[model samples]
Target: MTAVRIEREIERKYDAAADFALPDLTGLPGALGEPEVQRLDATYFDTTDLRLAARGITLRRRTGGTDAGWHLKFPVGRGVKEEIRLPLGRAAKTVPKELAGLVRAYTRGRALRPIARIETTRTLRRLLDAQGNPLAEIADDAVTGQALDRTEPVAWHELEVELTAGEPGLLDLLDERVRAAGASPAGSGSKLLRLLDHR
Candidate 1:
């Protein structure tokens, strides 16, 4: 099965503290929901020499959380990306045939191998409008990364506030708040990129 999504994920990342307190989000469209917690483990695949990462493309197999499967994300434009998701059935560490075919142009006969693994403990707080519609989500994540073929493990904490059904301006509002609560903006492309850079 093939599924495509036009994802407009506008968010900011910040350096997290051990005892980080999230800023008040009740001032948003509606109010914040009770925090929902989950653990996410994702392994990213890439060609040696990092061809895919150089071109802002990412392929990963992730388990846990609301969406657990294989995802191929490619940059479409600034702050927006296109994601193609394939379900996990009998496939193990091998990349699914269908999903692999989609990135043939990038692989170009090269092998795709696991480059990095990031495990995160996420706390999700849904921001809703007065009509009970989802506006955005605030994710506070504590991450541990293990780079493939490498021995050292890297660990860090980050906060992401992604706009869901909310207006783009909501991110701006949230960014201001998160900054006030002492979060420094992250400079990496994604969690995978951040993990690999430490190597």
Candidate 2:
């Protein structure tokens, strides 16, 4: 096994929440509002009992369009989380060993398995500036979740805003527009948390 220099840290949850709205790149002149589109798929993961409730770490194998792989995301800040994706391998049921060590602080050697599954249908909008460079990506998502332990299916709708690699002010600008659109921020850190909660 390759030993990667892993950065370990803990994230605290807060009460702040809002709705996200940005722009859709696929729809340029038309924007995301012109024609509504949706991308649907399910995410699977494993977690310890208490960890699922508190920390919300999800280890799952995902198959979809461009981003089909194993994803682990740690909560970072408000409306932001650090996401890491590994290529999918034969070990679909077990968490990748490389990633398992990364979550060692939370798992403490406990075994992990699929505890929840989440299905999401996302409507995307791409935001850009006058220069035509991508400013941010806005996704309006309808989510359905299944918790394996409790056999409960929950559903909700929320907005997501992902920033481009440029000035921080751009995100602030988009944030204003999103809030103006009457969308409130949804908590749970990242998509990974939503997946864990479903399980």
Candidate 3:
């Protein structure tokens, strides 16, 4: 079975150290709640020359957390993208044809192969409004990335804040809190891009 998700996916990434943590967000429209931990493992695929990535499209098969599945994402605008999901079928590590078709125009008949794999241990927190309605999710992650072409693995820490239900201004408010916590914006385009570039 398959499911489609159309979210604005407005998010920002910041580099972190091992002992990184979040600052007080209670001052914003939504207050930060307790943290919940989830593990995410995603194997990214693309043609040898990375045609999909060249166009800001990313395809990955991931396991862990509530949204574990095959996710195909393409950029729609700044900080926004479209994601399509399909079940991790019975096949062993294979890309679904349906998803492949969607990106066929960009792929131009090239083969999709696993190029990089990233594993992240994430701590998540929900941002809630005055009435306890959820507004956003803030995630702090420790990451390990390995490129199939390279033998060494790269390790890093980062933070990501994703909006669930809230006005766009909430994102900017939360952004201020993160920046004040001694964290800086990410130096790469995406997790997969970071891995491929290092290798």
Candidate 4:
């Protein structure tokens, strides 16, 4: 079994217009880094009956980023989740045993299968303190999603600000600034759930 790593994710999402630009965040307590671009592709898995989705548990295999691998996220609270990650070791189209075992309570012996695929073109920037410590990361995403049903694919633009080494209050401060610039709070909790039209 490969090593399993755990992390806490605290982030917020926003829906953006087709022409939305990232607002000036330098006015806050940190310095903004140069923007980096990445193309990310991910496939989300769930039981046919959608048991995991109902419980807010997500398992996905993703590639094309610094953290490319298999990720299983469990909701802890609003805007908070505990993420378990494992390396991708030639197991395309297959969920790793370690990750599967973690969600067995919800899966209840049912099989997990690919339910949706999401492709993202991401422009990422980091918010750093005067000391050069990372405070948070802002992602501007152009996303396309399609369910396994093979129906029409949907696409949209969204923004995310995730805490790295920052305090929780930083989110609230950014929230006001981001909204003043015209982005609305995300109507959906996650990209997968939005893709599956759960919310």
Best by lDDT: 4
* True-vs-predicted CA distance for residue 112, candidate 1, Å: 0.9
At residue 38, what lDDT does model 3 achieve? 97
- For model 2, residues 17-75, the per-residue Cα lDDT tens digits are 23433332342322233324565554555555646336655566776545667777666
| Global lDDT of each candidate | 0.83, 0.58, 0.84, 0.90
Cα displacement (Å) at residue 191, model 3:
0.5
Residue pairs in collision within model 1:
none
Across residues 27-74, which tens digit of lDDT does each residue of candidate 3 receive?
677777887899999999899989988887899999998888888888
Residue by residue across 1-199, what tens digits does model 1's lDDT show? 4554445556666777867899876556768888999999998998888889888888999999998888888887666677778776566578888778988888898988888898999999988887877888889999999988799999988988777788889888888888888887886768888887888
Best of the candidates, TM-score: 4
Instruction: For each candidate in turn, give its C-alpha RMSD to the true structure in angstroms.
Output: 1.7, 5.7, 1.5, 1.3
TM-score of each: 0.92, 0.72, 0.93, 0.96
Worst 10 residues of 2 by lDDT: 8-17
Question: Candidate 4 — which residues are off by over 4 angstroms?
Answer: none
Superior candidate under TM-score, 2 versus 4: 4
In candidate 1, which residue ranges exceed 4 Å CA deviation? 2-6
- lDDT (Cα, tens digit) per residue for candidate 4, span 131-160: 988899999999999988768899999999
Candidate 2 local accuracy as lDDT?
Answer: 0.58
| Candidate structures ordered by lDDT, highest first | 4, 3, 1, 2
- Candidate 3 — which residues are off by over 4 angstroms? 130-132
